[model samples]
Structures are given as C-alpha cells and as structure tokens.
Target: MSKALSKAKGFKQSKSGTYLSMATTAYGVFGVAKQVKKARREHDTLRLLDAAVSAAAIVTGLALLVRELKRLGDDDVLLG
Candidate 1:
C-alpha cells in the first residue's frame, strides 16, 4: 500500500514537471510569434532578428523535450 502511494506520488511529480516544461516552451513560442508580428509592423532588420531568435528557441525547446522524453523512457524501463 505504501509503495503504491509512493509510486503514485512520484508519477504525479514527473507529470507535473513535464507539464511545466511544456508550458514554458509554449510561452516562448507565443513570445516569438508576438515579436514577429511587431517586427512586421515596424523594421525589417528587427524582423529578421526575431525570426532567428524564434527559430533558435523552437530548436532548443524541441531538443530539450526530446532529451527529457528519452530520459523518462529509460527511467521507466529501469523501474519496470
């Protein structure tokens, strides 16, 4: 019973961590989108900068997410 409870708690924590990370990534993407719109309304150089920054953020976020997912998979295998 205690073991089951502990496992549940750990699972909840892991899920929460993943959810928070995803939320952060989503916010970063939204920020980039806003900047792109603003740049379009204003300067060409700033627009390019925004595009570059957005691309970098997306790539980094995807890499981080993939790494985390792989780690989680390995952890599950170990636990099982």
Candidate 2:
C-alpha cells in the first residue's frame, strides 16, 4: 500500500538523517581538534581562541545530534 511505503520511506529518511548528523558532528570535532593542535604548535593566542570556539560549537552539535538520535529511536519504537 502507498501508506505503508510512505511510512517505510520516512523511517529510512529519519535513520539517514540521524547518521548524517552524527557524521557531520564527528567531522566538526576532528576539524576543531586539528585546528587547536596547529594553533598550539604556532603559539597563536588568537588562533587558539578561535579553535576553542569551534570546539565548543562542535560539542554542541554533537549533543544536539545525540538528542535527535534519541528522539528518532523513540519515534521508531512508537511506530513499530
């Protein structure tokens, strides 16, 4: 049925979105870490501050992704 197909597609989309969000968050964290390491090596206070802010953003993104994933899990359980 079309309704069943739609539900399946929606489920896939939700899972894919969660995975993508987690992947992006991980990449952001890795990028910030690299920047911080480079800044430390160069002894640049400004760069360090920038890196710190970026790191904080990445952490926030990760937390948001975790919350979203949890929500998706609950939704999946409810749907099933």
Name the best candidate (by lDDT): 2
CA RMSD, predictions in order: 4.6, 3.6
| Residue 25 CA displacement from its true place in model 2, Å | 1.5
Candidate 2 has a TM-score of 0.69
Give one clash count per candidate, in the order shown. 0, 0
Assess the local accuracy of residue 3 in candidate 1 as a C-alpha lDDT between 0 and 100: 75
lDDT by residue for model 2 (1-80), tens:
67777776675347566777678678877777888899999999999999988888878887887777777765662265
The per-model lDDT (C-alpha) reads: 0.68, 0.76
Which sections of candidate 1 miss by over 4 Å?
Answer: 1-15, 74-80
The lDDT, on a scale of 0 to 1, for candidate 2 is 0.76
